[model samples]
Target: MIYVITIAIYLIGLVIIGFFKAKQIKTQSDFSVAGRALTPWVLVGTMLATWMGTGSILGNAGKTYQTGMAGLWLPLGSVLGIIILTQIAGKVRSYNKFTVPEIIGERYGQVARLLSVIALVLAYMVIVSYQYNAGGAVLHTIFTDDSGVSAISVETGTIIAAVFIILYTMLAGLLSVVYTDVANGIIILISFMIAIPIFLVEAGGFDGMQIAFSEMGKPEHMRFFGVYSFIDIINFCLPGFLLIMGDANMYQRFFC
Candidate 1:
């Protein structure tokens, strides 16, 4: 019940923020771009929250659980991509356009813009769907009884998540998203700060983990490659690299 309450409180705080921000949304530009007045720190927070989604917290974490240290390679591609993006971030921001397709349209043509829009729509739809699933999974985990039955079904949780996300986005557009993202970024940072040490201590540190893996007959789990071939690493990495490079969310933040 405490866990559920905490989740509810967090969501209620976001709703309150959205409500307040909506009052300031008098025009399309204000709603879409926060009137182009976001502080550097808010931009940092938004970027962190945008990039660190279900893929980072659940997908990559699960891969790491299975593959051990080699799972780090999965995110290394995105890290490298972000580094490359930094070189062009200033240029992207200077374009001062509303969206990635706008910049592409100016550079290429209407045909290219239409193609980019189609691609972005497809990609974002998939991202949002999985995000809803992730939200549902979170709720299921939180509400499941010791007997393994959940108070609410994953489908119901998914519907709730989808409704909240759609309504929140519609309320104040990017203004609400950026503000809530700042809060989320702080929460995530604080969670890592508190959890990592506790986790390491409970696991008895790297040497303990190594010994445990050896005893479990899974010593390969401690290795850098972790039973995966070089080709497998490349394959795991390339898609994330390419996706991050072309991610519309990150580019839209840059535009803001």
Candidate 2:
């Protein structure tokens, strides 16, 4: 009942926010680029929140669980991406493009734009599918019940989340997404902060965590740069860094 109530409240809040923002959306331009009027902080918040979704949360958690500290390098890569992006912020802002493909097409030509669109669509669809799957998993865990309704409950919860996201996004575009993302980021940060201390207390504190880690025989897990050679870091960073150098999302944010 508590779980249901919590989810109901969250859904209601999201719907309310969407409805309120819906009035602000007047055209495709407003939806797609938020009238290109986003401030720097809003742009940064949205980019960070969007980038740190299910793929970052669940995927990184699983990886950290399996490989210990070494798994953290993936998120560290994103920090580097942000730093690289800062250097080119001026250029990106100047481009004033909607999609990455548009920017690429303008810079490289029609063929580049066509290829970028194909790639972007595939990437975004896969991301959306994964978010759906993750939401279902979270709902199932939250509303665990042995009655055969767990599956149905989880699926229903997932569908509800998907519908909300689709409707909110469809109604207002990037403006709504960016504003909601800022709120979402704050919520996630606060929730994690509160949960972590509670979790630590429940798990028996720092000594308990140490004992647990020792029993798991993973002392090296605490080191962020452990086991990564210079060449390895370079190899992992090179392509991604280079790609962001020309990323369309970066350009769009700049234009806005």
Model 1 C-alpha lDDT per residue in residues 143-244, reported as the tens digit of each score:
999999999889988887887777778899999999999999999999999999998898889999999989998888788854778889889888888989
Once model 1 is optimally superposed onto the true structure by TM-score, how far is the C-alpha of residue 194 displaced, in angstroms?
Answer: 1.1
Per-residue lDDT, model 2, residue 81, is 78
> Which residues of candidate 1, in runs, are more than 4 Å off?
none
Q: For this target, which candidate reaches the highest lDDT against the unseen true structure? A: 1
Q: Give the candidate number with the greatest TM-score.
A: 1
RMSD of each: 1.1, 3.1
CA lDDT, every model vs. true structure: 0.89, 0.74
After superposition of all CA atoms, the RMSD between model 1 and the true structure is 1.1
Q: Kindly report which residue stretches of model 2 are placed more than 4 angstroms away from their true locations once superposed.
A: 146-157, 200-207, 220-251
Candidate 2 structure lDDT: 0.74
Model 1 lDDT-worst window of ten = 220-229
TM-scores for every predicted model:
0.97, 0.83
- RMSD (Cα, Å) of candidate 2? 3.1
Model 2: pairs clashing at backbone N, Cα or C within 3 Å: 93-254, 100-248
